[model samples]
Structure formats: C-alpha cells, structure tokens
Target: MMYQLGKRIESIVLPVEMLQQLKPSDFPNQWEYEAWQRRNLKILEAGLLLHPLLPLDKTDTAAQQLRQIIRGALEKPLETGKNNKTMQALRSIALSLACRTFDGSVSETSHWADGFPLNLRIYQMLLEACFDVNDETSVIEEVDEVLELVKKTWVVLGMNQMLHDLCFLWILFNRYVVTGQVESDLLFAANNLLMEVEKDAKAMTDPDYSKIISSTLGTILGWAEKRLLAYHNYFHSDNTETMECVVSMAVLSAKIMVEDISHEYHRTRKEIDLARERVDNYIRSSLRVAFVQASFQYFSIMSLHRMSSTR
Candidate 1:
C-alpha cells in the first residue's frame, strides 16, 4: 500500500504552461492535494541533500543518484495507468529542477532530450511569475538566491555550461527589462559566458543552444544600447564610471560578434552574422560613433591610470 502511494505521488504531472498560472492559493484544499505538496517538498529536499561544492570526481554517480531519487519518488503501482503526456512534463521539470538544484548533469535520456526546451520555457515563466507577484525587494532577494544555486550548478556541468549560463543571464536580463534596475552580475555572467563559448566553439553548433544564444545576444545588445543612450544624455553629468562600464560592455559585445559569428569556422556562421549585423545597425542608429570612440579612449586612460597607481 505504501509503495503504491509513492508511485501515485511520482505520477503527478503538471503541464509546463500551468506553472505560470500556479499560485499558493491554487492548492486544492483536500487531503490528496496536501499529500501531493508534501511529496514534492520531500523530493525537493532530497534533491538538495548533496553538497554542490564537491569536486566533480563522481559527477556521473551524482547524476545517477539524482536520477534514482527521482525515480524512487516516481515509483507507481501497476494498476495506475500511465499518463504519458503528464509524465513527460513531470520528468522534464524534475530533471531540470534536479540539474538546477544539485549541479547534477542533465540526463540525455529520451524524455529529457525531447522536452528540454519546454522545460526551460516553464522555468522562465515561473520566474516571471515570482517577480510579478511578490514585492520587488523580496523577489530580488529570492531571485538572487535561486540564481546563486544556478551559478553553483554551472561549475559542475561540462557539456551544458553554455546553455545554463545563457539561462542564468536571460533571467537577469528579463528582470532588468521588466524592472529598470540592472544587476552588475548579469554583465559579469555575460562576460564569463562569452569567454567559455570562445574557449569551446562547438556550443555554437547545438541548434537549441544556438537559438537561445542568438536571441540573447540581441537582447544584450539592446540593453547596452539603452545604457549608451543614457550615457550620451549624462556625458556632462560626471558619470564617468558609468560611461566607462557601458563602453567596456559594448566592446565585449563587439568581441563576441567578431569572435563567434564572424569566424568562418563557426558552423552557423551565416545566420549568426546576420544577427550580429542587425544588432550593430541598431546600436549605430541609436548612438554616435564619436561618442563610442571617446568612451573607449576614456576607459583606456582609466585602465592605464589604475595600472600606474598599483605600481
């Protein structure tokens, strides 16, 4: 009887689309609903049991352990018919949450492979809901906490680091878009992502990864353009530090374009090139070339001064 009950818990699957509409009040006030909540809570608890800081010496085993824990939660009786669609959704969410929470590897199992994109979309929707419903202060704190977990996970996964980082940055980017406040860490993550991608160029070839990367690059460039316009307005208001940071980011954006898209070696070079050109044209139309040149020169001089002062 206990075994059968556990299986029923695992079989509970919520559609990815429904996650956005989910609310604390949405929990049905009944014994079964309460049981379902408790089960999910336990799964989340077990998911976070292992330390994320541990060396990747046994990551494969860690992945297996996570999979087993999820499987254990999912154990069901033979009499309970399969809900294939719901199971797929649950498995996708489970694997994504497990990977995000535990720093475990993303399972390449058929279920995970088929539904990774949908899983990502669901996570983003949940995040958006979190921001929209909660007070900004609490939401920022919560989002930051969640993002820290993601950053830790990024340390463990080798093959999926780019995808994870892009997701992380996109969350921050979306946050900034919705709320005008910028997080410096988003820019920092962007820089690190560009460095990682440059070091391993093959990530550009994965269709899913490439699709997200292309869209994210445009979003980032758009943000930078907005910042540049702000700098242009305040150029005489003693915002040198802000101007310098914005210019440095723009330079990094250009470097990403030149290195990733412009390289003839990239498999999706043509599509990426067009994307880059679109962003460049957008930037050019919004800001002056001479202003950009001046900001770069100013940034360079500031760097030199800091170097001299340290010596």
Candidate 2:
C-alpha cells in the first residue's frame, strides 16, 4: 500500500491515484470496503473542510465545492476509478485546500491532517493503541513501544511534547471513566501528568496550543468538578480511594484555566484560594442538598401517617 510510504512525508497521505485504483473486492467484504472508503472520504472532509491548519477563506469555492461533492458521495458513493470525473475533481479541490497557507505562498507541505481538534482526535486514536486489544480496559505492556510509534506521528500531526502530555492526560482520564472509574491508578497517573501540563501551560505561548490545551483542560476540569462539587453525592466509603486524586486534579485544572487561559483572573488569581474555595463550596453545597432531601423525606413520611389515620 503506497510502498510502505515513509512516515511523515510532509503530510502526504493516500494519493488520489492509489485511491482511484481501489475496488470493493480488495477488502474482505463489501461492507468493510465501503466503510474504509467512507472513512477516507470523511478524513478528507475533516482535514480540508472542517479543520484545515490555516484560516479558510469564506470566498474560496474550493471548500464549498468539496462539501457538495462529499455530500453527494454520502447519498451515493462515487466511483474511484481513474477515468471518473468526480474523483478527479475531488483530488483537485482537496489538494488546493490542503496546500493553501496563511502567507499565500506555494509549498509542498500539506496541512490536511494537521488541524486543531482533528490532529488531537487522531492522536487520541493512536493513543488508544496502547491499550490491550484482548483486554480493552487494561494497558498493554508494550505501551512504551506504542508511544514511540505515537511520537513519530508528532511530525505529521504538528504536535510537540506539551500537546502530547495534554492528550495523554485526557486519554488516561477518559479510560479511567469508561472502565467504571474503579481504577484509581489511572486517575493518579493523569493527575501526575497534569502537573507537567501545568508547567507547560505556564510557558507555552502558541495560540493553537493554547486553544487545544484550554479545551482539553476544560474538559478534564468539567468532569472533575462534577464529582468534586458534591463529593458527598458521588463518593462513598466504598469508593473514597479516588477522591484525593479527583480533588487534586479538579483544583489543578481550575488553577491552570484561571491563571493561564482566563484574562479575567489575571490580577485577582494570586489572592484567590483555588483549593480551599473549591472544597468549601463542595462541602456547603453537598450539606445543603442532603439537608433538603432529608426534610423532604421526613415531611413525606408524616403526610403518609396522617393519611393512614384519616382512613
């Protein structure tokens, strides 16, 4: 397949020529082939149309034209044969978008797959490869080897160590969540990694990196806050082991967002106590909720007793 195409060849992907020659029989079944074909097209849609590396011009018909072509393909899959007119047009516009840059210069470097969330999503998928295939909840022993392969993709994805740390943080957090949140070690690992991200957040200045880190940290913080904001509601004696890591992460992510990403917090942040404030809020809110629930249950029981006496 494309001569084992050397990795990170200036963002080059499966060429239009190779795509044109593909057929359904080449795969194990029609469904698999169609899925593969649809996926390739969607990748093009994501990279070129949805999230190209550069700011897309609204006046550029190439984007609109590509959108229409993809939409039509969705309704009716297009032929990929060499002589197909649709394939030729798809190749042209897709390349045009992939090759365009901010400075209006012609360059061989394609930015197709190097966009913001798209690159992050691709990196996350690659990160998932670290998990054991047989035991989806567990990590493979060869994670270092898999990570080495992942780091090589950084060249293609326009990623650096900082972004890698952030993605790895969320990946671990998510795996912990999806695996029933019993694995406190994953939470611990994510919190430790987040310490590195906090340092990176302080020093890194790239806008793209900022945008991604903000969203990624926001997501991690959002999930953390839900549990921490009412720890009594969620955590119990049976599952209190993960609470420390959760609270630490929640507070750290909040501090990072406030100190690094938020303009409003610049002057007042140093005076504000993130940990103490968060813990106080959680305790007060949870106690108020519990008190209200208890009152409601007591009143309901009294009303039921009165109804029994009247009967």
Candidate 3:
C-alpha cells in the first residue's frame, strides 16, 4: 500500500491502519490476535511517542491521548474493527503528530521510527541481513544485493550515507568480535569502514551526527585499544593480521574522535606521530603485562621445584 500510495506515507497511519484493517479471523485465535495487536501497539508507542524525531510536547493533549490508548491497549486489546471509535481517535492524533515539520508545515516523509539510537538499531538489524543466518560469521555472497535493497528504506529510516557507513562499520566490527574474532576479514573490512567514517567525521559538523559518531567511535576505540595495549596476550605471530587491523582501527578511531570531539582541536604534523605514539604505548603496556605474567609463572615453577626437592 505504501508503494501503491507512491511511498508518501508520512505518518504512523501506515502501520496503524494495517493493524486496524486486520480481522480477528486472520489469526489462529483471539488470544493470538490480541498478542500481535499489543506487540504492534508497543512498536507504535516506541516509534511515535517514546523516541519521536521531534521532541514531544508534554502538554500536547493529543500525545497524551495517544499514550492512553496505547497503555490501555497494552493491558486489554483495543477493538480495531474498521468502524471502531478507538481506532478513529488513534488515527486522528497519530497523523497529527507525524505531519509536523521543521518549517512549520508537513512533508511527504514522516519520521515516526527514525529517531537516533532507534534508527541505528533498526538499520543495524537490516545490515545483519548481509550476514548468513545459517553461519553467522559468514557474510552472504548476496550482500551487495541485500545492501542495495536495504538502502531503499533509507528515506523512511532517515539514514544518509554517513550514518549508513557508521552503522555498517559497527556491525562489521561487532560481528567480528562476537564471532570469536576468527573472521579477520570482517575486522579488516571494519577498519576500511572506519576510514570512511573518519572522512565523514572530518567533513560533517552537525552536532547530532557528531554526537552519535563520537559515541560510536569511542566504543570502537576503547575496544581496539584494550586489545592493542595487550597485544602480547591478544595477538600472536599467527594472528599478526588481526593485530594490524586492530592497530589501524584504534589509531583511526582516536584520530577521528580527538579531532571531531574536541572543540579546541588543532591539527599538526602529528598524524604520523599519532600512530607512532599509540603503537609505542601499546608495546610498552603489553610488554609490562607480558613481563608480569612471565615473572608470576617463573616464581610458580620455582616454588613447585623447591617443594619437590624438599619432598
């Protein structure tokens, strides 16, 4: 229906109407219908009320009314028959909220479920389609096709190329980590995406974008640094490939975060020095940890040997 309507939904009505138009007979039982109904209603509440693109007006009676309807329906399924009065009231108020615009007039695109973290979560889930479900570590060969199809929803998702890159970077890095870090390719690909994010960070000055980027890169940097600073433990000669990727990612994330996050940031010929200094710190820290571990092992063996001699 959205495509039939030229994809100009611009409101929560799209999902809400679809729910309302369903007949109870469409489900296996009344209980099933009610459960499905409640779940969707929570989605609407999450998308429309909890994390709306526009800051909700606490004084808006219509918003309150919408909440009441959701809250009530969560407890008891609301009648959603085509002629139901409750559905009529919900449709009216939800449409009103969704039609709001920055210039004080409505647009053909609405942002009900497209708020910051929510949008990121949804987009990341979509990007997960690129990974094979049967083997979670393996990216599907059809990833390019899946991504192209996923990009079609960017308008409704309020995603731009920069946001997509950032989200995809996180997905790659996280999937790599979660899958026992065996897919060096995923880590390698994530470092590549981090470079794109670095470019975007340098180009964009929008605070909203910066905030999200900063938070995300901070996480990536912290995780990357943890491993890099303990490379003696985290990486072996066999996995030097992983070490290379982690170092590159850590340096890039720190560079981007430092440059974009600091208002007083000044650029110098320090780019080369940044990597040098970071790698130096990682080496020193890792050597210290390695030394401590070796000493502890040496003392433990010595104690065991002394006990055997005495025995």
lDDT of each: 0.48, 0.82, 0.83
Top lDDT: which candidate number?
3
lDDT measured at residue 46 in model 2 versus the true structure, 0 to 100: 86
Ranking by TM-score: 3, 2, 1
lDDT (Cα, 0-100) at 21 in candidate 1: 29
Model 3's TM-score against the true structure? 0.92
**lDDT score for candidate 1 against the true structure:** 0.48
Model 3: per-residue lDDT, tens digit, 93-178? Answer: 78887777767787566676687667788889999999998998999999999999999778777889999999999899899988
Ranking by lDDT: 3, 2, 1
Between the candidate structures 2 and 3, which one is better when assessed by TM-score? Answer: 3
Which ranges in model 1 have alpha carbons more than 4 Å from their true place? Answer: 1-26, 29-116, 125-159, 182-203, 226-230, 234-238, 262-311
- Residue-level lDDT of model 1, residues 38-108, one tens digit each, is 45534333333332212224555545554564455446411111455443544554445434323455433
Which candidate leads in TM-score? 3
TM-score of each: 0.44, 0.81, 0.92
Write candidate 2's Cα lDDT for 1-311 as tens digits.
43565434664654443466578888999888777777888888887778888878898898999999989987777798767899889887777888887789866776778898899999999999998888767888989998998998776687889989999998999999889887677888899999999999989878877787788888888888787766777888877768877888888888888888776775674577887898888788778877888899999999999999999
